[model samples]
Target: MNRRKQKKLTNRLVWAAAVGDTCTVRTVLRTGVDPELPEADGTTALYAASVHGAASTVRALLRAGALPNTESRGITDGTPLCGAAAWGHVATVRELLTHGADPNLREDGGAGSTPLFWARNGASGPHPETEAALVAAGATD
Candidate 1:
C-alpha cells in the first residue's frame, strides 16, 4: 500500500475499534492490515477498543498480536489498561489483563498515574469491578 492508502486503512482500523465494529476490525486485519498501527494520537486499534469498552474487539485485537501495554503520548498518554480502567470497563480490563497488560504501568506524564488512578478518579468515578481487577493485578494507588 502507498502511504496515503496505508494511512487511510490505519484510520479505518482505529475507527472500527472505537465504534465497536468487531467484524470490520477482522475484515481490515484479514486484508493484511496490521492491527498495531498507531493512529495520529499514538493509539493502536487495541487501545481504542479498550478505551471504548469493546470487549470482543479487544480480544480479537489481542489475538491478532496487539500489544496489551503499548503506551501513547497525547493529551491522554497511557496504556490500554489505563484507558479501559478510566472508562470503568471491567470486562475489557479483564480481557487486557488476561492478555498480559500491566495494570501497574503508569502513564507517561502528569502525575505518572496508573490505571488504578484512572479507575478511581476518571470521569466514570471509581468502578468496583475495575478497581478490584486492578488490585488483583497488583496495581497501586
Candidate 2:
C-alpha cells in the first residue's frame, strides 16, 4: 500500500480501537497496521483503548510500540493514565502505569490537574483499586 492508504488504514484502526471494537482492532493489527496512529484530535489508539476500557486492545497496542505516555490528539496535557483513571478503569490504569505512564502529569491547557486529581474528582466515592494504582504509580494528592 502507498503512504496515503497506509495512513488511512491506521486512522481507521485507531478509531475502531477507540470505539471499543475489539474485533476490528484485532483484524487491523493482524493486517500489520501501525497501532500508534493518532486521531485528528491527537488521540492515539492507546488513548482510545484506555478511554473505552478495552484492556486487551490497550495491551495489544502497547505491545505493538504505542507509547503509553504519548500526548497526541491535541490533548498534550492528558495522558493515557489520566484517561483510564478518570474513567475508573482500574486495570487499564494499572497497565498504563506499569508501562511508564506518569500519573502526576498535569492536564493540558493549564488545567493544573494530575491523573490522581481527575480520578478522585471524577469518582463517585473511594475507589481503593484506582487509588492504589494511582498512588503506586507516584500520583500525589
Candidate 3:
C-alpha cells in the first residue's frame, strides 16, 4: 500500500478502537495493519482506546506491541497514559500501566505534569476511578 492508504488504514483502526468497535479493530489488525500507526493528530490506536475506556482494545493493541507512551497531536504533547487519566478510564489506565506505561512521563515543553497530575486535576466524575487507578499504578501525586 502507498503511504496515504497506509495512513488512512491506521486512522481507521484508531477510530474503531476509540468508538469501542473491538471486532472491527481486530479484523483490521488481522489484515496486517500496523497497530502502532498514529493518526494525523498523532493519536495511536492505544491512545484512542485509552481515552475511550476500551480496556480490551487497549490490551489487544499492547499485545500487538503498541507503545503506551506514544505522543498525541497538537501542542498538548500528551501520551496515552495522559489520555486515559484525563478521561477517567480506570481500567484502561490500569491496563496501560501493566503494559509498562510510565505514570510519571510528562509531556514536552512546560507541561511537565505527570499522568497522576492529569488524573488528579482533570477528573470530574463521581467515581474518581482514574485517580485511583493512577495511584495503584504508583502515581505519587
- Winner by TM-score: 1
> Using TM-score as the measure, what is the rank order of every candidate, best first?
1, 3, 2
The per-residue C-alpha lDDT of model 3 at residue 27 equals 81
Reference-based TM-score, model 3:
0.86
Per-residue lDDT of candidate 3, residues 9-72 (tens digit): 8988988998988888888888677897877877778878887889999988888888888776
Question: CA lDDT of each candidate?
Answer: 0.86, 0.75, 0.80
Pick the winner on lDDT between candidates 1 and 2. 1
- Compute the lDDT of residue 106 as modeled in candidate 1: 81
Report the lDDT tens digits of candidate 1 across residue range 1-141: 787877888889999998999999998888777788887777789888989999999999999888898876664467888899999999999999999988788877545788998898876788888999899988876
lDDT minimum window of 10 residues, candidate 2: 70-79
Question: Model 3, which residues run further than 4 Å from truth?
Answer: 75-77, 123-127
